[model samples]
Target: MLKDDQFWISDDKAKLDMSVIKGYLARSYWAGQRLEEIIERSVQNSLCYGIYRAEGQVGFARVVTDDATIYYLCDVFIDEEFRGMGLGKKLVQYITQSERFRNIPGMLGTRDAHELYEQFEFRRDGDILMRRRPDHMRS
Candidate 1:
């Protein structure tokens, strides 16, 4: 867990609010078409992080790892109402610098937020990132 002023981030899955997560993902272009069941299952299988203010859950990010070599960071977001407050940066920094992931290579995909991840050493490598939209997300 990490704290920044009035906001805090936790990896305890028990603290995540499904409604809040679902609400955001349902509108996310990368996950908009994903089913609720799939979301739940994904959360269960990965290392989940939730950002919160006293009001409630406000941000989220998840990493899929083998507990050995590499990791894939995805589904990262800071609530629309809290976008400029730096919660997203704090969340990414905490996770990336953690003892387990600090020196390990990882990858993340973003169509436009490349600048944010670049600060943490995630560079743009076309070969490292690829895409195949789900059937429903394709036109």
Candidate 2:
């Protein structure tokens, strides 16, 4: 987990530091399986992947949306060197503005970050969402 500092997510059209971004992805759990594979899968699946860089890559997130009225936001991460700087919140803001996600119902999971999501109007309605881990992955 990233410490609470030195990170910032941006919606600006700034040049991305791909090398650093790749480094972070390479160290991620499931994503570390293969950077090329992960990038390709994200593109093919129509998932929007965002990376935060400050001196290096500090955060990442992917949004699954249909360019319509429903969006499943997932896989948000902030590198250990960068956290608590609002990068994750900024990334969510950036993704929500897309024509595909604007006005759509968005959802995500977080062991933490409930406060950040609250700023975007995300709420826990008990009936709003649920999940089941793959049987094979369950302990």
Candidate 3:
């Protein structure tokens, strides 16, 4: 768990607000075509991270990993009202630098957040994809 006052990110799916997640994704360019059933199944099959405050869920991200060689970080978003607060970086940092994933190489797709993820060593792979090297652990 990563904390910032009352706002924190947890890897507990039960703590997630499916509505907020789905609503956000439903309007996202990358995930807009995804259906509720698809989102639900993805959460069930991946490790979900939900960011919350006293209000409710405000951000989300999920990781598809094998715990041994690779991982895929996807569906990342921070609520509009929560933007400009650095929560996205905090969330990505928490996931990438945590004990379980610290040394693991991973991948993510972002339409325009390259500079943000690049701070964590995620370099370009393709048009919308970025690859984090295996050495992308916190120093």
Candidate 4:
């Protein structure tokens, strides 16, 4: 059972068989790959992760790190059906306030989520924002 404030979250994929994860991602425009593969990839890259509910992966957030410090937050997603209920805020708070994340200076890029992250001290600096998506993956 997963709660908004719980650290340990378990989804059906860890126990029973279910396709909801894949279905959710497919509907969300995540390109290719099956549910199990996606789940495996997410698990592999996260320093720590949680899967909410038994049917769907309502949210996911990961830390890109060099182990000791310097962590980059990436891949934050909250299922469309589950948005607007403060779940995203809770997830961000959990990630940034945790002891594991406190010492590390966390960084993330967001299109419209600045308000939520602002509560966690994430500010939209007007100095410099840069990206370099390679040609092969150019948009």
Q: Top TM-score: which candidate number?
A: 3
Q: Over 4 Å off in model 3, which ranges?
A: 136-139
Worst 10 residues of 2 by lDDT: 130-139
lDDT of each: 0.85, 0.57, 0.91, 0.56
| Residues 42-135 of candidate 2: C-alpha lDDT, one tens digit per residue | 6356564445444655666666767455577765666676576667766766665554565666777665566676666667545434232221
Task: Please identify model 2 stretches exceeding 4 Å from their true place.
Answer: 1-43, 127-139
Clash pairs of candidate 4? none
On TM-score, who's better, 1 or 3? 3
Query: After TM-score superposition, what is the CA distance of residue 5 in candidate 1 from its true location, in Å?
Result: 2.9
Q: List, in order, the clash count of every candidate structure.
A: 0, 2, 0, 0
Better of 3 and 4 by TM-score: 3
Residue-by-residue lDDT tens digits, candidate 4, 31-110: 34446676657646565444566454567666677745467765566678778867777677676666666666667766
What TM-score does prediction 3 earn?
0.95
lDDT of 1 by residue, 91-117 (tens): 988888788787667788888787788
TM-scores, each model vs. reference:
0.89, 0.59, 0.95, 0.63
**How much is the lDDT of residue 54 in candidate 3?**
92
Q: Candidate 2: lDDT of 49?
A: 49
